[model samples]
Target: MASFFRSAVSPSSHPSPQQAAAAAVAAAGDAAVKNLSSTFRLPFASLWSQSAAPLSGQRAAAQAAAAAQAAALAHKEAAAAAVHASRQSTYNTLFTILAVVATILITEQVLYRRKKAHLPGPTWTIPIIGKFADSLRPSLEKYQAGWNSGPLSVASVFHIFIVIASSNEHTRRILNSPMYAEPCLVASAKTVLCADNWVFLNGKAHVDYRRGLNTLFTRQALATYLTIQEKIYRSYFAKWLADPSPAPTPYMMHFRDLNMETSLRVFCGDYIPDEGAKQISDSYWLITVALELVNFPFAFPGTKVYKAIQARKLTMKWFEHTARESKKRMAAGEEVTCLTDAWVKAMIDAREGSDKLADESRKVLVRDFTDREIAMVLLSFLFASQDAMSSAVTYLFQHMADRPEILRKVREEQYRIRGADLDAPLTLEQVDDMEYTKMTVKESLRVKPPVIMVPYVARKPFPIDPSYTAPKGSMVIPSFWNSLHDPNVYPEPELLRPERWMEGKDSPAELNPKNYLVFGSGPHYCIGQQYALIHLTAVLGTASVLMNWEHEITPLSEQVE
Candidate 1:
């Protein structure tokens, strides 16, 4: 079984400010409740136990007992009358509540069937939270079991109907059919990624916005980002070599920090300080935890959603500041240094003559975006890629550590291209020339894919196939695993075999292009796929040359959580 590397990084290692605060409060509340409940219960129990004890003096006790019995009979009669009235009232309230709940459930069931007509799914969903208990502790095997049931399976959470596409045909159809579906992440996604972020755009708006932003991740753009990325990689690798852990500790967080620093430097560069990058990198874990496939919708105080919102505010504040500074420098005719500067230059170049801006397919290339808007776009990119990339980075290390032969292959290619010049900067040609490194990265992603599924919401009646219709407004998730691991498409799909990618047309992997849904498909597919691949290849290549990491094997390491 496989797992989403997003949550695969343990949150226990890096505790966010909000998470710490919430834990402290919960602990205090539990202690107080425990003391108060014991204080009340102990005294009440003692009084009840001693109530029937015998009186000390026999003669006085007889007279007193006779009087007490008469008084007790009167009290009992009065209490019985009151108890009867209270019981009647409580029973009536219970009946009313149960009736209301039954009515709602019945209506929900009716609507579910109406929408589900002819589809393959459950006979009836669990009242309010279908499959939620299982969700609390999820597994890839559990998900795969559902997928194996049929091409499509349905479930509901908080009354929100969900349709999962398990078959390659159904999954690809959902992914490619943007006219009928659009990305609809969990209820809390808007809170974390921001509502107006370009990621949430649909149809033509999404396509148009994506077109303008695609310039930020082009090969040329990646070339520009490479210098900064290589520098960051070296810095982090140096830090890892200096780690204080006595034994092999989980390096997932170390990899995460590297990814965050790389992204921060690549996106904002000199506009952000070293301290700023470290702070954001440490704080980003809360956002990752909050963006899980499911989360409590309301951002109540002390909730993961609330902590993530706070983290987002901090990250965006820095991003917006960087955008402003980049705009100022670019307008003043300064040289482009980082991604922000690169983006600002792109906007400026779009106004200039036909060099890079001459692409006529762009409807609006030169449009000015506000500082907040620019920051939001950067935030969206981070939101979409960070945890997934972190996963890749972690697995990249583990895979390379376990297989020195492949690592040797990657190293050979790196050295061949760089020509023993360790100090020389990484160039785009070097990155592209490392074909074996690219294959290694690709195979790692396939074996331990960063993202498992992309959640899309149906916009209209989607005739996904002749047999079933995807209901409007329901979540239609296109699972990537089924296609990526199709036995016919990838012989020994579970094995970490990079050669499969280069085995020519006779290779199942090369011929089955559709099976490689690594970046997804259609309109909402990852716009940064090439940038991600090149970045991973370069980082792994550099690591192979610079450092040696030994992956510690644990029983649970191979099991997906």
Candidate 2:
């Protein structure tokens, strides 16, 4: 009751108990202040009162700073834990990657050695690079060494598996059985010839397409090509005469150029302008150079593919031009002259009347061929003729030069067939009647065929023989050189004697079809076989009669370029 009465004095009065105690103490302090103020005669009491509130505010601020410091330490600890977890995760990932890489490398090495242990090749391949070093510039001797390794030997480089089929039976099995092997012409084929060309076609499609091409090389067509061949040879022979020296230059390059020019003229006739044909002939070497067994396939500006693509474009343009012109001329009812003309006339004849078959005299389907299709056909002709014809012509000159005695007989035969003025064009019948010249051509091709190997693709797993079965997708190369040069069949295999074919012992045509894989043996054999021989016979016969040449044989003369 007393405390209530005392505290009710005013609304601003302090509370009782502890409040009263504080009030009493404050009253005492006020009294003391008043005393001091009286003694000093100053405003010090007010100054003290003003500083007390500010001191209380500063104390609250100090407490807040302490609390903030504790909170900051907790946050720092949490951040440190997060960083530690991230580092641990990264280390685990790195370890896992390294382990996988090591495992893969070990597996690869083990498998590589295991496969190589039984195969017949170099005792040791050049590490991971394998035979790449030797493959750069392959040699006939090196190939022969590999061929002699075993009847069937395996080689692996850059994961590619190559099986060498050595024996004649094994080779024939590889070529005839197109179910386990395929031709792997260098990496540059896709670049040199477009991917669309029929030469790259495989399986039954390739076989059927090749069948259609046989009509283009019929005896009549071949006869027509021979006339062109004779005319071209006579013209080039006169150019050879301008040299005036008895000694002959390399002549292989000259012969190659002549063959290419003549091929172009025969294929295109006057439809291809002279300047354009010359340009194509000159630039065609780019395509040949890109045809090495191995090459970089990138089409970047400086790559082999890029250069080859440029050559293909040039050739394609001329081929398409020839097709257009031939079509126009054939529509006007002109006589078929060159290959292009013959093809166009056939197409027209098929369109007009009864189904005109491409096979010699047989009329079959009257299908119309596109301009591009015709171009692709011509491309096949060029592919079949270019390298093969060049090699044959070069060897023909070489054999003639080396065997002057044989050359004398050949010249005499040509003179007996054609007069001393050998400038006259040869008829198809006249060319076929030159039995001796034909025998010489056949013998020359047999001794050193322009194409040494025939490549075929396997459609599936093929059981080639009882002991040897080619693995699917492997390049089982069948080299015809062994078969063509067999000792038992030819007796003196290395010797170039045309009389062996002419001797009444065996029908050269029949006994040798199995051995003469020069044009391949099975369904996909060269369609232009007859035309090729006819052209060769005409060139050689004319050259023998008109031109006198010699060979400057180098160590590399007999080697493939």
Candidate 3:
């Protein structure tokens, strides 16, 4: 049988059924091995071929091995190519990012230098943040150095280019030329005060708005506010005297509280409760802190701007409520008490064509302002007056305390004006009679003007001078310190000599009205100049007679901060 099978399987011969079936099975196994090798491209295909059909499958196995080896080599080459391409892509991405950063940095430097152009500032700014660290902790000495650098010095903070006007002529030009510039308090003013605040208004809108509100500071209104001011002053003086702390404590914040309370009572009367006033006063410092020349732009959580915004919202809520109540009270024919009452009464008279509208210019239009509008106006007054008045009072006390002779003169004048009736209700006549006190306040303001500089924005390319044109959208700051402290204007600007103001019209300070920028100049000058003067005069005059305190000179006494 074996011999027959071999013969049958031998060269192309027909065989018996069993031998044919065996050969067919072997052929099928070899075919399967070839198929598997081609489909899987596996390295073990040769071993499979040998196991499936060892006799006639040698050549098939060899072919399968060659095919599998070729397939493996191709896959290896493809993987290597993929790795090379991936590495190249990563390197290209890194290079592109680096190039973009470098280009931005270069452009920033180039633009800064171009805008700076022949000004006194750093030759090359410290990249994007540019004097940001210096700004964070601004110092009077540093500011003086910059102002002394040149008439028109330059600086960049967070890409906001600044042109500081140190000379009196240049400063006044920037302030008076509203056509080329307008008040832009600081980077964070609009954010803290709201963009639509009246203080932010420009051109005709600001003028008209200011005109309508001028009556709030009229002589009549000042008289009314005086009564409220005296009561607040007496109340605070009592509290200060009652303090049990034997050791000298810093009264800076106490003076701030006094000013805030006085301002609140004068602005809104009893509309704001004690707790509310305290809350507003505490939060107001955040607003002051955030008013830096340049601040972190975003109002992120825990940031100064964010805290100030929250404080503003809280304060505005009370102010708006006060407005609504004032309107109702004025409509009911109640006696005017605060500035809001006076304003609301004016509006009512203007609407009714009442004979009380004595001055046509003081009369409001037929259109009535909403509570929010009224509140915003009141907020503006507080913002404009609060810190400045606080500084005036604190320094006034300190200056007088430091110089006993000055304090003695102030007391003598207070006694002469009131004529031994220290507790008498303060009147406009009494406030006016305190001329020495007024000069003291003015001199205090001059020696340490609460507002050292007023920041403005160039509405266009401001030709601040023939040599230098401040670029459009740049900050053009008018510094009052240099002008107020100019040795040329006042021979001894550093000394707190109130008699300088008493020298009448020919005095250097009086002759150069431009130099006395205590209340600023131009259309945007402090509208409440008279009101502020009167307020300070009344507080100091009253304190001179009614209370006595001393300033203990500590190491930090002279520190401006």
Candidate 4:
């Protein structure tokens, strides 16, 4: 058994032929199997490992694709949500804005209607800026329509409610009721004239300040102003005669220049140089233009109010300097020559107890005003008198030229007063004695009053009548045109008849002093009433004597601007 096992185990050992053949076949079969196993082992293992790796990579790619898809879906959902929220927020904001605007507009109308009350204005105001367009280009026809609407017609401008008083009684009430209202002038008056100007002072302050100024318009002061005025009138009249223009020209501006020079000389004397006077005269029209009923409220550059402010500054410079110089000369005991000198001397006399004052009623506790204060007062005077006086003088000349009969009578009266010596100086007594000349001035002023209305502001709720109460902060305007032109007050009111003043005690005009609102009425009535009359009388009287000019009637001669 041991031998047989050795033979089977050792193939290389010798054996029988049959056994060897069998062993060879078996060995060959075993060798083939071993070769096949050796060849396929590494290839199958590599295929299995490579296939397993690809499968693992494919699995990783599938997981990554699933994660990317999920991220993309989340991003899309977030974008849609963000868009929805954004749309919601926009709608909310727009709705809020619309609601607020609607509320404001509704509130505006409600407030306007409440303030309008029962007055005779438009049924509904022109939203925000009512009547602003009409104010920009004011016309007499429109004003008349408004006045004819009712005695207390209502209107609004820039949300500011306005009440217009057209009847004589209502106009006078607004003027006299100091407890309820005070002079507001126009919307721009406070800005053009400084807010702190003495003219804007109210109540006792205004009274006290005005009391001290009465001395400047007395009879003695008028005589002094008249001398200076006469020199200017003569100079201007001589220049007018010397002009080489053969054709008729517009002398309105020339008259304005003449008036400006007269006013400056009367107010400042030689203290304002000729060049300075010309500069102020040339620039004064800016102030006039800026003082319209309505203007841009601010003093921005290149605006009318701005230009007027610059002009005011320039004028005040010279005026303040004049005040300083006049104070020095007055303290040195010089004769009073100008308004500034008169004021300074009055202050000095009041301090020294001099009895030169006209009366006790005119006397007041005078204070030493600063140069700026004195300058401001003079500026107020110029602001008050310049334009009105210019218009008066221009119309006086035109009226005299148009009606030679009137001119003949004026000339006759002038000659009768001065007795062929036209070059002689004038006096207040002489001015007073020319009753016909005074009547002409009064009629001229009545026909075309320089100021048609005065504006006042309500300090509190004013019971203007038993029916309607003027709201606080509202503008109350008193129109003089209707009252002055009332047919009952002056029959045929459109006609310019100086004889109406000469009609004596029972004359319609003489019986009703309230209708004469040319210079205004009540506490704020023109303080220079006597001075204005005297000035106009003297100017007309002088012109009637010194020179003669003709009026060339155009189609526009009878038209009122």
- lDDT winner among the candidates? 4
- Looking at model 4, residue 252 earns an lDDT score of 85
TM-score of 2: 0.78
Question: Residue-wise lDDT of candidate 2 within 199-285, one digit each (tens)?
Answer: 777778777666655567767777777777777777788888877777646666888888888888888988888898888887778
lDDT tens digits, residue span 1-561, model 3: 444545657986666797688877767776787887687776477677767687567888889999999999999999999999999999999999999999998998999999999988999888889889998788888998999899999988888899999998999999899999999888778888989999988888888888878878888999999899889889988888888888888887888888899889999999999999989999999998888777775689999999999999999999999999999999999999999999988888878776655554444444599999988888888998888888878888899899889889989988887886677898998788888888888888888888888889999999999988999999999998888888887888799898988898998878887788888888898999998898888888888887778888887677674
Question: TM-score, each model?
Answer: 0.82, 0.78, 0.87, 0.89
The residue pairs found clashing in candidate 3 are: none
Specify the poorest-scoring 10-residue window by lDDT in model 1.
Answer: 1-10
Question: Model 1: how far is 77 from its true place, Å?
Answer: 13
In candidate 3, what residue range of length 10 has the lowest lDDT sum? 357-366
Instruction: Give me the runs in candidate 1 sitting further than 4 Å from their true place.
Output: 1-91, 113-121, 244-246
Tell me which of candidates 3 and 4 scores higher on lDDT.
4
Displacement of residue 53 (Cα, Å) in model 2 is 28
TM-score of predicted structure 1: 0.82
The segments of candidate 2 whose C-alpha lies over 4 angstroms from its true place after superposition are 1-119, 123-128, 244-248, 355-365, 419-421, 454-459, 505-512
For every model shown, the clashing-pair count is 0, 10, 0, 0
Candidate 1 per-residue C-alpha lDDT over 304-380 given as tens digits, one digit per residue, 9 for 90 to 100: 99999999999998999999999999989988788788788888888774377647423466778889989998888
As a whole number from 0 to 100, the lDDT of residue 12 in candidate 3 is 61
lDDT of 4 at 391: 80
By lDDT: ranked, best first: 4, 3, 1, 2
Candidate 2 local Cα displacement, residue 37, angstroms: 23
Candidate 1 vs 2: which has more TM-score: 1
Better of 2 and 4 by TM-score: 4
